[model samples]
Target: SQGEGPDPYDEILQAFKIMDTEENGFLTLADLKQICESVNLNFSNKIIQEMIEEADNTGDGKISLTEFTSIMCQTGRFKYCAPK
Candidate 1:
């Protein structure tokens, strides 16, 4: 559709990797804070913590790719259709 550009799922994974600065395979509070600031968003710590909690499905205070994908699907930002 977009002239053979990268898959949408790959794009999402790439974005997650970029945000995971710690290279620990998950997103922590500090990573979120740094990205927010880089994008000129001055979110308070409470707001950031809330964001983490919202997506941290495992309740481990960090967001893994599975958690991120679940949130995206819940928010209608991503939809997965199995091959027919």
Candidate 2:
């Protein structure tokens, strides 16, 4: 199953809240690296670069909240589950 029943937008927003420490609408490569580190997810620089390029829709060096959320869902890293 995909997981919980919360609205996808809400899920995305929650992800954004977690990633966007600066409260800015965009995330830098450093931000992505930090997230990877926090999750103990070992990722190569090439993979990170590809993720940024694939996820950063605006063509800017940073990724927007929406973009980040979409990537997370697509990657199965974030699953919406019921509260335990």
Candidate 3:
């Protein structure tokens, strides 16, 4: 179900757009928290920190769309959520 959708790319892009606070093609820890909150998902600050460290390839304290998508695809959630 990795790519099962009318527009998986659009869905991914929209997720990134929502998470990118500065609109500079990167998502910060705050952006991650905000995105989770918007979906009513509660994640600890510790977990968020770990995710950021693990996914933020550039070590810039921000994650890019490519990195986020890679993580989501691995988690198997991208298949179900529609573009917001």
Candidate 4:
């Protein structure tokens, strides 16, 4: 049963992989913008700024998987972008 189930983390990892083009385990602001656009979740500047402040745990301008997951989960619901 375990192997038959679709991986829950797959959705989250797929979303991250979409944005992390460089495969550097981090995402730039532009990558974030692209993701938001894909999901039709246009965030206000205030919200985006708040996300960086709250989720950028490492103090790097780039967002790591942990930070991204925390932010995504905090958004009321997880929004997986439809693959293009």
Tell me, by TM-score, which candidate is best. Answer: 1
Model 3 segments more than 4 A misplaced: 1-5, 77-84
Tens-digit lDDT track of model 3 for 1-84: 455547766788887897887788888878888888888989998888898999988788778888888777777676535345
Higher-TM-score candidate of 1 and 2: 1
Taken over the whole model, the C-alpha lDDT of each candidate is: 0.84, 0.74, 0.80, 0.74
| lDDT: the better of candidates 2 and 3 | 3
Tens-digit lDDT track of model 2 for 2-76: 565666567668777777767777877777778898999978877888888998888987888767766777766
Candidate 1 accuracy as lDDT: 0.84
Error of 2 at 11 (Å): 1.0
lDDT of 4 by residue, 12-72 (tens): 7888898887788988766767678788999875676666677789888778988888777
**lDDT of candidate 2 at residue 74, scale 0 to 100:** 78
lDDT of 1 at 3: 78
In angstroms, the error of model 3 at 5 is: 7.4
TM-score of each: 0.82, 0.65, 0.68, 0.63
Clashes of 4: 0
Distance from true location, Cα of 80 in model 4, Å: 13
Residue-level lDDT tens digits of model 1 in 13-40: 8878999999899999999999999999
lDDT of 4 at 6: 67
